[model samples]
Target: MSVTVERAVCATPSTQRSLLPVVGSGTQVPLVDGTSRVYANLDYAASAPALDAVAARVTEVLPLYASVHRGAGYLSQVSTALYEASRQTIARFVGARPEDVAIITRNTTDSLNLLARIVPTGPDGSPGRVLVLDLEHHANLLPWVQGSGHRTTILPIGPTVAATLQSLAAELSAWQYTLVAVTGASNVTGEGLPVADVVALAHTAGARVVVDGAQLVPHRGFSLTATDADYVAFSGHKTYAPFGAGALVGRRDWLDDGTPYLAGGGAVRDVRTDRTLWQPAPARHEAGSPNVIGAIALAEACAVLAALPDGALAAHELALRTRLVAGLEGIAGVEVLRIWPDSTEPVGVVTFTVEGHDPGLVAAYLAAEHGIGVRDGRFCAHPLLVRLGAPGGAIRASVGVGTPGEAVDRLLIALADYLTTGPLARYVVEDGCWVVADDTRPLIPVHGLDGLAATAAACGPTVEAASGSCRPRRAAHTAA
Candidate 1:
């Protein structure tokens, strides 16, 4: 039986604030007419904004920051202890078995790639084949293709959820697959898969299951032990940590026997000039100085999420999702993508396209005119997008703990505005990206860049001159 946690009530505004503080919730952005509005980030499916609690944890640890598992100094020992303790914390949070190992990685992609390296090959000296669904993120798909030395069979999604499960069961029974890799939720549609059912089917077929929980863990509660999944991978960025850390938690036997992921300092027990003895599981995988802060931040996020009253987070997201889906369905010329239309328990991700408008243009207009940030692309799931008949891509709006009902209303209003009046300013396609033509808003610094002018100047003279213009053009208003 699937272990069910107690579901918490939906979060009120005050409770939402207490659940997790997020960065950039009140950030301002300027529209084409030079008026600034508070930015509404609807792109949590890509990367969520950092939680203020996570930030505070980092700040608390910074002063004592030092190399992990390396130095003998006081700070180093503290850092090392915290790093190792974080492993246990994360594992416990995921409901891992006592024998399971938790290996820290850079992100979900990194974690899956590491697993790819360790997955055992078949007896004939050929690599084992992995069964994967078409609806996987590139992080889950490409690693097995490029690194696992395995032949992957991409299973087509059925028209309905039941049909999809049936297909998986049929395939598992027919093939001697080494692993069954599946996503806990569809990143594109936010539809939660029946992970417990998938696990049962895969296990009955003598295949181990790996769940790409990058999207699921943040929105719903999951237990690896309860689900009987062999492995679970997720990223901290998507879970409101925003630190450069992720985890692969699963069975220890394969990881312990497999070659170390990185052959460096901390991975070895004793090294001779000719040969070296490797450490067990985690230490073997983590060969160098670890991302101590990132790991701690991820653990902090896990702790916070775990402490949330049973279904509080899920309840809040579900309410927002209902509003969003209903609002979008009410709009003309808008089609919301879904793998299973009858699914009643989807997360807060919604992908759609407006009739007669390019997805990129619609996304640009939302940002440029409405200060609403959304993602428009194949979402790194090109095959799924193509399969869904969105070869040109679509718009994705995903919400999280930080998202408010007002944000959902704003998105609906913006979409309605777009349908009624279209974009107020002309858009131009530059280098495959749709951008506002002759935009003059001041540039926002990102990734440690000083300003847009500095970045442009670093690129070239023509771009530098273009970046210097910030005088606003006349407002172009359209009747709504």
Candidate 2:
């Protein structure tokens, strides 16, 4: 699906507004040339700006926030009802099966880790083998390594998406794996996986499939029943809500039969010195006061996204992706990265490398000169980055409903300027980072965190301020 959007050749915040309303969309930031510009946030894949609706939802929930479960107070009962209702909303957002249970989690990583810790042993009484592609993000790949009854067989990605599917089929036929875990989309290149087909392959081979939907849920329509995947995990931060809430929606059998993710408070039905009886499924997994407001906000985000006119969001983002990719490719020194030649654009995450510029420096220059926020590093998919021949790192510009066309145009212009005439401001290495010399931009004061902003400013160009993705300096390996 694609939508026709007017293209702009020059950079300006007034060009066009977002398709969906979001907080901090028109916020201005100080640039190095004693001028300020509207902050163009092109790093949606990392953490999307909060949707206006989600913030409102949070505000509404905060007053109702009281102790969850076992409370006689009116507010407590209301909060408990809201928490469980939010779970149902989350489940419905992904088109979960009636038997599926949505467990509240911190993020996708925490969800995956929880499942990993509880996987049941196979009939052979050993941790069975799991099949996975090399292209998955660390959140998807690393969790399997720690699964109690599973060891992963990392399959090398093929030359094409078709070949990769065939390879997965072959791998499944050759081995009796217990599970097949895969990413819904490649976080590094935005290449979506054929999840329905993958689910079919895995189920045909008698293995359950887990689709990491951290990247997919934010951009496209996802239905677990349509795909027939046994499980799917996602985070609210990537789904247009703020951080602190995520979900693991999947079959109830495994979660009910397995060990509880946590063993405190609401998790147990009866507790004594000698014995304990754990609750089932969601109650078994969730065992604390919980993030009442975060869950409500996340549910609000999901409801809002699910109610959009069919294909509206997908069309808007893919259109932006096409324009951004073409513009970047048109540059002389910029090389847009892709995993499969035949893979169509799934979301708007696009990574590229400049011929003669350090990724960190390029990101810093963009922040200092253009007020554009982009990410530059391995993106926590170190394995994928290494395979793409960008072990050092690369620049990534991801878009969402909050992004305007002018932001994309601005990024292209900034990159072209850097490639052609170099950075407008002088730069020198400070604290092992390439920072604008004598950057005079005053740090914004964050309430209650007195001197924290200034302290960060004193430390020249922290990773979040410059690259927002500078990773540990080390050899590329099979590690997060």
Candidate 3:
């Protein structure tokens, strides 16, 4: 049952390649002044850096890119064919039916907006009821809250599975909601919802469910067909394909009959001065020329995830997360943000607040002083933050395919340092955060790019060597 950890360090973007070439130099950002630093990318929840393979694939296909759909030229035909094929590939990867409409939008936000627009109008022409959880990102929450007069029911995800299920059951039993929009995983704490159970409950109440997979898909592969949800949405940027593209994958009927969310040339099957007949589900929602290049890049990213050796990638991320949680434990004044410790269903992202420290200050110190890149804010999960009694927010450290063990060590070391020496004197922002890292007052790197690269390459392999097994393999890759 033990998983072998496969090294995917070679998968980093070339710009991130270290001097020795094996380990990655901190971030792609060039530190103007020489300082000792390792690019610790702990922002995978917000957006994962593009996989080298995904980027290379995009580059290879860019020159061949042309307008898609019904163009007479060979390039157009090729592009159209590739675009449609990408849809099928994505659908299959996500366990969706081949006929399921896979429409690309700007991001998760855009996909939810489109889904909101297409919801079947409720009885008496009133907007239908929408059920959402307190843990949902604003991207999932705002769309329904702002949608056409939809009566909203904010469902609470209790601290325990039994409590959560019972609460959701009671809510579903009472209301005939049209749609239940839930996050597959919490971006802040990396807690995965019991989506299959939620979907069953919603369906029993005669409501459809929309899963926000932006956080879920990046850390773990997902299958909509097996998920029991009616629709799934996620962003490519979070999935290591930062082309500003996202997908809304679901059944065809709602999209086919619903009014087109965006109206344009490709989306129209027939047009007249008086009236126009809209195209099918995907095209009806996709109005513009479309980010063909972005979609291809995202598809390529998905393919890269698909091709990764068994459970190697997920195990790697999970190992890094375990290290993070363990390292932070017993540290005085550190409070880890968590949802239901009894549940093992989570990705690597972990959030915590250091006592007597501003999250912004801590995050800034990590980035400027240590050359670490982490996110610190409400993380767009304001409601969840409020519920957790965190008025400001928490510092978040997330790992992914490219993150190395040393980077995590550096983060823990930095926090340990902060805990030892009260918050550094220079960390306080006088005017505002914008004033601290302004172009005028740049934080110098201790190690120049060359020195940093050399250190990273030398230290990288050593750090990974300590990742003593206990990793989980991909579901299919395991022999069991």
Candidate 4:
């Protein structure tokens, strides 16, 4: 991976403050004189910082990084053993049997796409009728919808289980579907789903089920065995192992019957000049050089998570989520966009909009002014965001395993600042959108990543104080 994507794997503010080695030491310095900008990284739903344990393990194994499967050297054999062992770790982490296949891929999107490619086609040679909810991330929705030439039936879900089940049952009874794909949690709202019911209903229609756990796996605990999903997929980046890795854990039979997701290399058991024999399920989907480092990091992350007591993590996350939502709700001009009725149990994420400002502008201002990195836009779940009346997107503030109460407070303060002064209008005239101090820039010596450095550089001249005259100068260029 390039430095840009690799940089995303670096430590979060919480981690930086803790035992983990902060990636951008110079960047961590605050822009303001007295204030060390405590980073409120409310984008865990997109990606999470690696746990200290995961990082330590990765460090321990870095020197051991070598080609897996069939390598002549001692390190290669060790690496191969570690690689296969990591799969078992993931299987056990998700409560899967030893024989269950766990194929590592680029991310949750890649995992779902792999599953979509490998699922058996129906008697008609298509994917057959497919069932999915409107609540799905595009990763979960599109793969099944487009990959299959089959008819698709969408299930509608809202805040309540009663309403969701009614609509879901109605649709399932109507279609000759072969598969049902549901997100175990909504990335936008952080809402946990009633996946067990979904699985039960889908099976009645003779359809296998796939759970998109990209969002669910990080914040909430899950059991693949308990859910009994035919397949469970998640991104490792979201699981605090942001090394461009993810997994799709599921049964063997369906995958074994279909064509592999990719061709060549490790996917083949043996290849003749004219004819090639494919490997078994997991190996079949993993072609070319596997992401050895990524897989190691992810396995370490899962192990760390598994070691934690069950309710401790969930309780901690829920407490943060509650704090975030309550804090956001108290702010004027802030509309807490929920999954509706507001009673739904969600993870440590809350997405909403400001009455007058654009979600993108709010997110940008938060990052630029507060050193708070939150996400804005559809978050790749455009359909759901659109339905929620955020046609563009909603500002997303997600808490992670390392997130703390103080960071949430900082985010609230930033939001309050925006509500009063309005979003930084992007274009300031003489000293427009001034960055009095932006430590995330290379010139400043603190900000490390090119994306962050570029962002910091783009922000203009810094003035300790601006008079009304300077403010008026900024206002002149404002469009009607």
Candidate 5:
């Protein structure tokens, strides 16, 4: 059941400051007209900028880093201890149950893929179907779709979010299944789900629940125990720790019962040419050298977020979202996207579309003319995007702890200007994105990156290029 989206009214602003410092919050980016502005980074939904606390933690551990569990040196001992402590820290941050173990992985996608590998099979040697909603990120949706012989049944969205929860309850009551997966919040609309209620329904129907928390952890805090979710996966990058570290925290039985995620060093209790005995997880799955620094940095972010005064984070984000959504809705040609009319508390995400303008053009115009950063396109939730009738694309502006009211005001002003008078610079479709024609923006030169283009040509086409899908090419030149 799908309901019409609702709009929020504008709120009066108070004397509010940024909640915390984030790296690159004040960095100036050159505009196309040889002017510049401090880049208003409103792309937190994609990847949040690093928190100063996380950066400090990384610096503290950089000198102490050594081989994890592969060395007996003093540095190794400290590194190993840090790695283990980090695992525990992340687990506790999510309110992990006593029996739950946090298995560190590369990111949310990697963590979900790992959990997919361990889904239990019946005595008949067939994995049962796992149920999911239609609004999941590809990270949660695709793993189950292309799972190891496990079928997937997606519940249809209801008119209202409340009605959707009812639909989920009915679906679970009627079907016999292995597990149920849902997103803690929708990445496209930023609506938080009734996770605890969903967990109760799934559990009552003899199923477990796993939440994709990549988008939720950065804004709203949740607990595996409070929500009664069996498992949860989240990305550190989204949580203000832009490191390649994430985790799957959940029941340990399935982990130990499954095959090792990777076969290599540190996975074995005993190894011989003829036979080997594997250790229990997470060591069993986390083979090869672990990302010690990344894990530690992620832990630091969790700690900092956990320490925020009660209601401080929520109040900060609510003010930002209010200004964003109300401003977009108030605009003459803009329409903010939402799934449920009853979605009471959404995060600091507002996706909108302007009439008669492509999302690519709007995004390009924002950056080139206003020095603002926003995400455009399907946002990796292709099915959801199609359902929302934004198959072409849409523009998303997400805020974080460091985002100030002035930044929100800037975005609104720039957008209003573009719609009212049209863009100052002409935009043309170029390499899958909109680009200003004959742009004169100078590239920031980095040391030792002169051969970057040569090295790429020497190697081969990037995975995107090879796959016939490439990112928005950053060239200043217009496409052929």
Candidate 6:
């Protein structure tokens, strides 16, 4: 199963470009030096660029969008049908059994939080104990600690992957744990874990296994039926949909028996002044108006990925990963981070650091000078980063179906240039971030609330005056 870097180096350029249709394949961006280049996006691990097919499907569904499951109009019926069909599409994509249910969520974090709410308490009416490894994203780690009727036991990873599995077996044998949450792959190192093995061990110990598949699903295929995992959670954005949807697919017994995740209109069958009766599995958890468009977009993405010729996408990514890893290893002072050195299975993610430069500065330099996008930070795995002795974090370059081999070459060339001659432009610490000196790019908002005060000021007093006078107006004409 191990493909050497030498074989990947021999792959033709055309073979790399035929991998998948990425949204921003040939997008060009201007660097700080007043030079423009086609952007090289190596930040797929954080949020992958949407697939062109997914975008097209979304556009096609927008004009017909309407309220789902609560209206009798034509568009409503269409939307409702599409939404439920999307659930089945995703369920089949994960190889869910007939009794399993797929619950639409906002993202992996929301899905895990919903599971945490439904996790049954022990005989003492207290939270049951859940086991997790140190190598988890905060999305997977934090939910178990917050409202997850479970006490979390954070286990440390051993020196090797085999040893880590052995440790998990030992821990499970020692306790009557209720559940075991693990990641299908490491977001930091891109190393695949033995998920099937983990599920077998947990099941033998009378515990259910939940996998955070946000990082794994995009790169590799999964089958809940084959693995016998109790639950799998993943984000649509990470899986090339980028439409603000996620899914939690698993066995239905616990979810059907527990209270609804959200309490609202669609979740309940009958509402009274004193008592209310909730609905069944999927509907019970989905309370308010759901994201019909996002769900359809996610389903379309799964269909497109599933339709790819067998082993085509995986082989393309492997070639790119091999080239990037081998190139990084050749550069002096570049240390590649890894949890398992002997593990050859990875998903096109590589993290590294330069000896004399900060990871943030290196990442900024790559973008400001070379127009190569990369992620620099702990990647939301703070505990794992602390254990790896990288409290400040490392630079991560992740590839996907649409990633071209030329982009990998550009990153390698940039890193070598940085190590040999230092950054082309001087960087300074600005607001706790490394930025190129005299750069003249407008600051883009990271989150919706970021720079809210400044945004309001820029809108001026006229906006405030208009807001006071604005009123909801009735529709000019009613359809039915």
lDDT of 4 by residue, 363-477 (tens): 6567666778787767777778878888866788887777766677778777766666554434222333222232232233444545434444454344223233211121322
lDDT, candidate 2, at 232: 92
Instruction: List residue ranges in candidate 5 displaced over 4 A.
Output: 1-15, 448-472, 475-480
Error of 3 at 440 (Å): 7.2
lDDT at 96, model 3: 86
- Which clashing pairs does model 5 show? 1-157, 1-158, 1-159, 2-158, 2-159, 3-159
* Superposed model 1: Cα runs more than 4 Å off: 1-19, 123-126, 445-451, 454-480
Per-candidate alpha-carbon RMSD to the true structure:
7.3, 5.3, 11.4, 8.5, 5.4, 8.5
Candidate 6: clashing pairs of residues: none
Worst 10 residues of 2 by lDDT: 471-480
Query: Could you give candidate 6's per-residue lDDT for residues 1-480 as a string of tens digits?
Result: 121222223233323563788798888877876778899999998899999999999999999899999899999999999999999998888889889999999999899989888888776787788999998998899988875557889999988888888999999999888899999888888885688999999999999999999888888878899899999999999899999999999999989988789999899999999999999989999999999999999999899888988988788888888888888877767788988866667887888877656788888889888999998878889898888878778899999988988899888877766765667777766445676665543334446544544544555422432332111111222100
> Tens digits of per-residue lDDT for model 1 on 299-330?
99999889899889888898788878777777
TM-score of each model, in listed order: 0.90, 0.91, 0.84, 0.84, 0.91, 0.89
- The local distance difference test score of each candidate is 0.82, 0.83, 0.74, 0.72, 0.83, 0.83
Q: Please report, as a residue range, the 10-residue window in candidate 6 with the lowest summed lDDT.
A: 471-480
Regions of model 4 farther than 4 Å from truth: 1-36, 124-126, 421-480
Better of 2 and 4 by lDDT: 2
Tens digit of per-residue lDDT, candidate 3, span 1-480: 121212222122222211111123344442324344457777788777787777787878887799997688989988898888777766666778766789888888998988888788676687788888888888988888784456788887798867887898898898778998988888888887678888888899999989999888877778878877889998889888888788989988988988788878778889989999898878888887888888887888887788777777677777778877877764667788887766665888899988777787777667655667888778778888888778677888987877777777777777776656543334324334411222222223554555434444544422322322111111221111
Give the lDDT of residue 33 in candidate 1. Answer: 76
Superposition TM-score, candidate 5 onto the true structure: 0.91
